[model samples]
Target: MKSHRNLVVAATAAALAAGLLVGTAGTGNASSDRVDSAPSSIKTVSSGWSIPWGLSWLPDGSALITERDSFKVFKLTQSGTKTQVGTVPNVVTTSGEGGLLGIAVSPNWNTDHYVYLMHTASEGNRIARMTFDGSSLSGYTTLVSGIKKNKYHNGGRLKFGPDGYLYATAGDAQTSDLAQDKNALNGKILRMTTDGKPAPGNPFGTLVYSYGHRNPQGLTWDSAGRLWEAELGNSTYDELNLIEPGKNYGWPTCEGSCSTSGMTNPKRQWSTGEASPSGVTYADGALYMAALKGERLWRIPVDGTSAGTPKAYYVSEYGRQRTVETVPGKNTLWLSTTNADNNGGEPDGADKVFQVELK
Candidate 1:
């Protein structure tokens, strides 16, 4: 088995060196607009997490993390000690990808104490809000529901935008036709208030901010206040999209790039094998994306709305990365591994959180 693994690595390295593995290495162009180096070091912050799926930092410098299958949430201190915060109510795991997912603390957490969560319920995927008193969670309220959920493709990423509104990503749930439906919440990025109503400036006066997404798991904003997403493709090309209100992203009609009218093309794309891009966070001038099947972190330099060529780092070194978040007011990033889950198939104690120093 060791010999076979070595041979596979050697073959993959040869393919990468020969330019056969697309987007697996840095594009050799030396320019100021592109990422020229990878992260300098990766230090494990914590271990023994069971498929840590969500990470959100609190004002007190602590982080709240969620376990996908266990439906439990933990409060992790900056020094790496984890204490069980509590389990989310009514979360159910269907396939491996479902169950407790993305989490975000409210921007006014000091006053309201609200924390948002996206999870798989028995009926479908839903978003809920809870109150946290810095130790325990309570006051659960279901904000949104009826998002289609299948055994696969249940998109569950939650975030609070810079505009102080909640933003969510919903998958097509394997129903390709729903991606094109503007009225449906599936396969769309939704912008809403804390009460789950549509935001005031939402396109179409509905919660649907943008439509035609396959399974977007990442959402972040650049320093310029432009929204960006990393979406998983259907067997062809994954995308890094510049999201605009009321614009169509061309998921079912076009996988990567097309000339279709009323469709927006991705700023950058990668073959599906090289980039099942998941969580994304923007820091400095680059958008860092966490890859699952690609098993790496991609640094895509962003200038205004355009993205330069991507550079890969930690390829196959940390197993499957599920989330990447920029530490607030710091040059470090917090990353979570999903190797203990069914997809990665690594041994027990395989899941971990790492603090990476950006170069």
Candidate 2:
């Protein structure tokens, strides 16, 4: 049987809704000589998810969450109620990191009511669309496929940009040479319309926007419409990059920042252990990154294309943060923990969703 645990007791949900679980200390590392601002509150919205990989807010203020291992999708209410909507069909869950991963609500959801999903299948990783009826999902339509997949390194993060185009991240799937191949769809950030066709104004005639990425999982656009990405490095360093159209981010040739010609360097880089950053969100003039291996949340201020020193927060308090999204029309964020994954080594009921007030 599929393990679905909803452990939100009435008392716990009431306490969290009343803001009784707020924290006011900077338990993690602060930036160089700069004091960290305390978050107004941090409360557990719900718990007992199994490796929740994707989170997307609906127009009605409810949220949709995807479980990576279970191939299940859930609808979470603000008052701490979780209902299993349905599971995506034909998802091939692998050992390391492959399954139903990222989800993005359609930009015209009020009319179209379509939701997009990225998942690992029998042939490779693919993107598909489904009709969401506000309670359950139906009508799975494969939009794009055949990117390549492996036990690890299937970059699966999807988002609808402000321009109403869908942007997706694709890893090299252990094929390092593919990052340098412009013709290959692997190791690229692809931009497409809702119908999965290449978006107009693309630098290439194809769907490839920026190429030469190893395993980029986080993507967000800044106030200036500049795209930012968080990438996992091989063994040396992880990177926070500013993406440009038709640009190439050096992968096999350069792990982090390099002096190689015709390759774009990262805006900031950190050692592998310190920052295996995943889903990122841009809000209130900063980019918030969820760290998996570092077990913390990083706040990096952005001024145009430049980035300042990064500060850590809630380190080890929430084991292995996976997704961080800024709540619409509010100064709060929705954060999801990934402690149920193998890398976290935590028991069942370790995964949770949190509501955090930004300072």
Candidate 3:
């Protein structure tokens, strides 16, 4: 049976009574965290939706959220209102982990009118640009191409870093060796210009910023502007790596952390059953990770380059958490689920997005 969602427990949630209460999303129970964490008050902001893969907030505080299989982009306002802005065209799914995957509003969206999307097309996975005049999508242009894609590992998360460059996670595409290949694009953290060219001062003088990754789907920066990544491992462990330029993460050779000579190890690691991590965001001196197979949200404390022990929340309470991003200028997080993932068996519109307040 499905438990009820959207009951607010504190006065903090009442501040959202303006428009966040307009839709079916409701403020839920105010419960203490499992352990040494803050009181987390959660409420559903949007429901009856599909797999909302990529979430990027705009300058106006509204957000553009992408659906994985639908190839549609929806505009979500602060008042909990959802609208279909436009559909990203020419998107094809691999029936596993491909489609209109990641979306990022250009840092200068107001001036450039450009919205970037990383999707699977007929050829392979590509990063493309489309003109979104705040209403519809037009003028499709391919920015970066030649990244391989497969049924399982597409590594499709995009974020504009503090340095103003676009960073993307490219999976190994079921081919492990390609991760260690310096010339190939797959299984690497790519830093590129807004124009889709290799960013200036790259380690390999190419788009590849770091290599030897498996299927990294999450990217975020701390207050210090240091990059941290979440990677899904093969059979043993999932990794939360402190990403560095031109470093090896040891994918096929090391699942989580190993004694490899030149390979960098994850700051913290988890068994696969404990954390099949996807999207992660930073807030309140911690990294919030959304787990798909593990079905939980992990809050890991960060002290510079070191990661403290992880504390979990909503374990098995939600089906599958997919994307977690910080609400800009707020002490809250927006968490999206992926219950409609993988197989064609699960019906669409079974997913929901929640507003988690770290009180």
Scored against the true structure, residue 4 in model 2 reaches a CA lDDT of 19
Model 3 lDDT per residue over 221-328, tens place: 999999999999998888888899999999888887778898988888878876789999998777899988766788877766777656667766676789999999
TM-score of each candidate? 0.93, 0.89, 0.89
Best by TM-score: 1
Candidates 1 and 3 compared by lDDT, better number: 1
Q: Please write out the lDDT profile of model 2 over residues 1-359, one tens digit for every residue.
A: 11211232344345445654222221122233242343568999998888999988899888889999899999998888999998999799768889999999997889999999999999999999999988889999999998899988899999999899999999999999998898888999999999999999989888899999999999998778889999888888888888888999999888887888988888878777767889999887778888888666877777666776666667566778899998878778899988877888877677989999877
lDDT of 1 by residue, 298-324 (tens): 888877766876767776767788899
TM-score-superior candidate, 1 or 3: 1
**Overall local distance difference test of candidate 2:** 0.84
Q: Point out the higher-scoring one by TM-score: 1 or 2.
A: 1
Q: In model 1, where do residues sit more than 4 Å from their true spots?
A: 1-38
Measured with C-alpha atoms, the lDDT of residue 213 in candidate 1 is 98
